[model samples]
Target: MLLNLYGIYGNFPLGKNDMIDNATQFGAAVASARKALGLTQRELALAINSGERFIVDLEAGKPTAQLGKALAAAKVVGLRLTATGTPQA
Candidate 1:
């Protein structure tokens, strides 16, 4: 199912930390996608051979220290990263 929703609907929290906010937003996105697919955090974490906290952090939008882990988690949660200079449709 294709779900179109803004992960960041309101103001970016109270703090003005864009980097942290970015990570949090990213995590929220993963969390949302997982919920949309009806997958528990543990289930998703196990599927990706990771810890629940890791998923929690990711869903919380924590900028991963390592890109590989982030990518792996994203893949496990059916998330993909695409780069496009053009405006999205």
Candidate 2:
């Protein structure tokens, strides 16, 4: 298990009130999804038409720097994006 920080985990089943933390959950989710599918960061990045560095950033939950690209990459990795809270109807 790769632990990024004191509270951050690098893989699935999230943890302790998980998604409540932040987009880190989303990023970690994407990374976990990709790994489960048996793909490397370089492969995922290529599939997303992005650079490995960007994918690394996204997986690291540093998305505040590039959200659109991160989401695009996430989509390429076959992960669906949805609003956590209630969407305005």
Candidate 3:
């Protein structure tokens, strides 16, 4: 339930759709959350039943990484993504 207002990613205000604009931002957030939880990439991968390479790519912000696995990793690390309707102008 960490909400970083200054951009470490959790619950920060985003663009119109509230979606992260790029993989680098997403990856940094994931890495930050993982570290905050004191879990190593390999440990998180094992906990989430994913491969170490997947974790590496995820932390590196690989744009084409599988959404399912990425979401799963985020969950294990306590990161939550939500969707909202387009913001009003």
Candidate 4:
């Protein structure tokens, strides 16, 4: 159900200027990808060196979740974001 919100395999192909728009959208992507990769929230937290609670909050779309850790979790699950028109670093 959640995966379908993004894609069958939870892979979203964004256009050059596409944006996630909000924390909930970003969280959904993260959750979908994590599941698609056969990971539980606690497992993902361990993999990202974060607390299980943090993963729960993140997947629940908690807007106050720390950005750096959130990005790290996303990275561990192979989710990426793009800022349109920004130069790659």
| Candidate with best TM-score | 4
lDDT of 3 by residue, 1-89 (tens): 22221223444333322346567677777777788777899999998898899999988989999989987887777676765456556
Pairs that collide, model 3: none
Per-residue lDDT tens digits of candidate 2, residues 1-88? Answer: 1222112332444443334345676678778767866789999888767789888878888747477777676666555543455545
lDDT on C-alpha atoms for all candidate structures: 0.59, 0.63, 0.71, 0.74
lDDT, candidate 3, equals 0.71
If the candidates were sorted by their lDDT against the true structure, best first, what order would they fall in?
4, 3, 2, 1
Worst 10-residue lDDT window, candidate 4: 1-10
| Candidate 3 Cα misplacement greater than 4 A, ranges | 1-19, 87-89
Question: Ten residues in a row with the worst lDDT in model 3?
Answer: 1-10
Model 4 local distance difference test score = 0.74
Q: Candidate 4 — which residues are off by over 4 angstroms? A: 1-18, 85-89
TM-score: model 4 vs. ground truth:
0.74
Model 4: per-residue Cα lDDT at residue 61: 93
**For residue 28, what is the lDDT in candidate 2?**
81
Q: Residue by residue across 27-72, what tens digits does model 4's lDDT show? A: 8778878887889999999998889999999988999999999988
What TM-scores do the predictions have?
0.62, 0.65, 0.72, 0.74
**Roughly what TM-score does model 2 have, to 2 decimal places?**
0.65
